[model samples]
Target chain A: MRPYLYIAKVRMLSALAYRFDVLSSIVIQCLAVIASCFFWIAAYGNQQAALGVTRDQMLTYTVMSSTLACLLTMNVENRIAASVQKGSVALDLLKPVNIFGIYLWEDIGSVAIAFLQNAVPLLLIGALFIVAPVPASAAHFLLFILSAAFSYMINWLIAALFGMWSFRIVRIFPLLCMKGHMIRLLSGSVIPLWFFPQWLQTVLSFLPFRYIYQLPLSVYIGILSPRETAAQMGIQFIWILLLGCLFFEIKKGVTRHLLVQGG
Target chain B: MPLIKVNDLVKEYTVIKKGKGLKGALKSLLHKEKEILRAVNHISFSIQHGEIVGYIGPNGAGKSTTVKMLSGILSPTSGEILIDGLSPQKDRKRVVQNLGVVFGQRSQLNWDLRLGESFELLKRIYRIDDRQYQENLAMMDAILEIHKFIHTPVRQLSLGQRMRGDLAAAMLHSPQVLFLDEPTIGLDVDGKQAIRKFVKEINRLKQTTVILTTHDLGDIQELCSRLIIISEGTIVEDGSLSDLIDRIAPYRILHVELYEEAELPIHPLAEKIRQDGTAAVYRFDKKKVTAAQLIEDLSCFCKMKDFRLEEARIEDIIRAAYHKKEKLEGV
Candidate 1:
């Protein structure tokens, strides 16, 4: 456990050392936030009661979801797939720690860094320039944090599953890109699912993406009642458990093949 | 028991064979022809404790594959390996805890961390105690002078410096077995010598068993007492350098620098291998005739300005073996 923690600590330090990349990411996020703010404000022009929320709430939702997006989406899958292709994953296998554990810890480290460098500043800027809604109460804020953590874990597990496919296939970037586009469209990050057609909204209720992007944002903005918030959190937990089990199964198969094929 | 034992070790890979041009590519995608490559054939060897054994071979000779399997990074298709009575396939964590591996072509350290920071991270990863960590660091700094560039990030360090840092990082846990795959590749004379010296010192002081794989003959001559030569996924020769030279090429060369141009001597015991304007080379089987007898016979044919005897080097012997194998394979 300590060794795994050390892996995370080193990753965080590495993230700090590469300040240029951090700065670039912050800049990109700032541009994205400003662009979306204008796009949403213009689209909502003079419509006070669009999607059952005021213009102010819609602006808050856009900014809030964008900030949450910074925390949830990670590049763990790309990095893992690259390592597999380059054969450097062999060195990781030689380590005493478990491969899945190492990646999980590294994801945690990146999340901590992303929250500090990308999320906090974007949220602050939104609060000043846009009418971002504050948390309804302390309890709602606490529940939102729990939901966000679950969302992070679920996202990592999904990425891990896709990454494990690289061991057997040569190219997975196409599938990964499609996954990103689908999540953005269905999870209400691009546009709130409330604005989608009735059939589409019902379809998204069956998928887990909404739990990651929409649930946490809606919870923070007090869009859901207490019972609804608890139900959504429960659904998020179910996704984590399902994704985790699947990840472990794939990980076992991949590691076994790695040993047999001498990757 | 031997510290490391391998019996009938084998590794096979299923590789997709791709064709050239658009037609071939389309055909390959439709048919998907696959071939099984036997990277490591059945090989058997055992090493006692504290032995610095040199594992040498040409490219694509299963050297890296064997090392990877032994270090638990890869599993054998069929065979048995016991590292201190533990099977890496069955007890990967325990076996890896006792083993340290370094590949010269790739680094295990994080490029963003300074040298000292990388060491510290490894220390925590390996769970080395404070006393052991400090003592090992001090000893490593003495041997490799790591303290000089300990603050520099790995990406900023030169190749030589990175190799030194890598060697130290691998030894952070004081592993009993160290597997170095081409540790001195692309290094200068000084860097190679420093690495050779470090391997010797660690082997001597801690009795750490070393399995070194390299292309440099100088490293083999200076560091290894025994050699294992592998070609085409199998061990061709395994013994001391002298024994290998004696068995594979039991001959000596007699170079005679002549005062003037002259015809080389034709003798039943010696062959005139090469000749220049004022120099001649005669190769003779030492078993058939002595150096003195060859020189005496050569003198009868020409006036010799100077003469010297040269024994077969490891490079020559290994090259002969490689060519012989190539002929047998008809490749």
Candidate 2:
């Protein structure tokens, strides 16, 4: 545990080392959020409400979900794939500490830094200009925070599980790109699930992607009732457990076929 | 019992046979042809505590593969490795706590952080107590002198400095077994000497068993008490340096400068291979003929101005050993 904490600490320091890269990413995320808010505003054109929600609610959802997207995205897949390609994964496996735990802590460290650098600024910009709605009450806000934590875990586990494929596949970048596009389209980060067709909505509800962005953002906007939020949070926990198990299963296969690329 | 024991270890890699061009790529996608390459082929050896053994072989001879298997980075296809009576594959975390590995071509240090920070991370990872950590640091510093660049970022340090830092990092936990895969590679004379000295001191003080793979014969001559030479994924020779030389290169060269050129009389155990002006060269088998007896027999006929005995060079000896296996396999 101490080792894991130190790994996270070292990761955090390294993530913060590149000031220009951090600043540029923050700018890009800010543009993405503002563009998303404007897109929602244009879609809602002169209408007080659509899909059982007002324009303000839709705007709030867009801002919060986009911000969450920026916060929850973890690059562990790319990191792992690159390490595998370069054969540095052997060095990582030499440590006594768990390799998966190292990836998780490194993600935590980078995400913690990203939160300070990207999410806070984007949220402040959203609040100042778009006038996004606050949570309905303190309880809803607490639930949103809890759901967001689960969202991070789910997103990270998905990335890590996908990263395990690098052990078997030579070209992983295209697959990773496909995963990103799928998550963006399905997780309701770009377009809220409410706007999707009924069949797509049902499909998403059955999938874990919705828990990554839509569920937490919905809680933040106070759209879900108390009972619904409880049920959804339970579903989020289930997704975490399921994904966690899948990750370990894939990890077992990965170790069995582990090929250190270069000496 | 030996601190480390390996029995008939083997590692095989499955390489996909892909042809050239887009047609081959498409064909490979549909019908993959797989080839199994046995990198470490049923090789077996053991090392006792505090022994600095050189695990040497030519490139792609499975030296790195063997090290990886021993360190639990790669699972062996068959056979068993016991580090202090524990299998690294079955008990990786426990076994790794007592083992340290260093690859000269790749570094384990975090390039983003200062060297000290990397050491700190290793300390926590290994759960070394503060007292032990401090003592080890002192020992490493005394030998490696890593403090000169401890505060420098790993990327900023020179290759020599980084190697020193890496050595210190691996030692921070005071591991009992150390695996160094070309630790002195790509280093200057001073850097190589520093690493060699460090290995010697660590083994002497801590009784840490070291298995090193290196192409540099100087390292073998200075550090390793025993040599394990692998060729074509098999042990070609394993013994002391002198013993190996004697086996692969069985004779010594004697250069004698006589007062005048003459037909050199040779004993049954010695062969006169070269004669130029007043100088003559005789190759003699050490097992059968002593240099003194050969010199006495030759000197009685002609007053020898000067004479010298030369053993075979280690490079030639190793090359012969490596080729000896290839010739046998060819047959």
Task: Report the number of the highest-DockQ candidate.
Answer: 2
Among the numbered candidates, top lDDT falls to: 2
Most TM-score-accurate candidate: 2
DockQ of each: 0.57, 0.86
Note the residue pairs that clash in candidate 1.
Answer: A259-B75
- RMSD of every candidate to native, in Å, equals 3.5, 2.4
- Native contacts conserved, per model: 0.77, 0.85
Work out the TM-score per prediction.
Answer: 0.92, 0.96
lDDT of 1 by residue, B261-326 (tens): 987868899888889988988887778999888888778888999988877666767776655532
TM-score of candidate 2 versus the correct structure, residues matched by position: 0.96
User: Which pairs of residues have clashing backbones in candidate 2?
Assistant: none
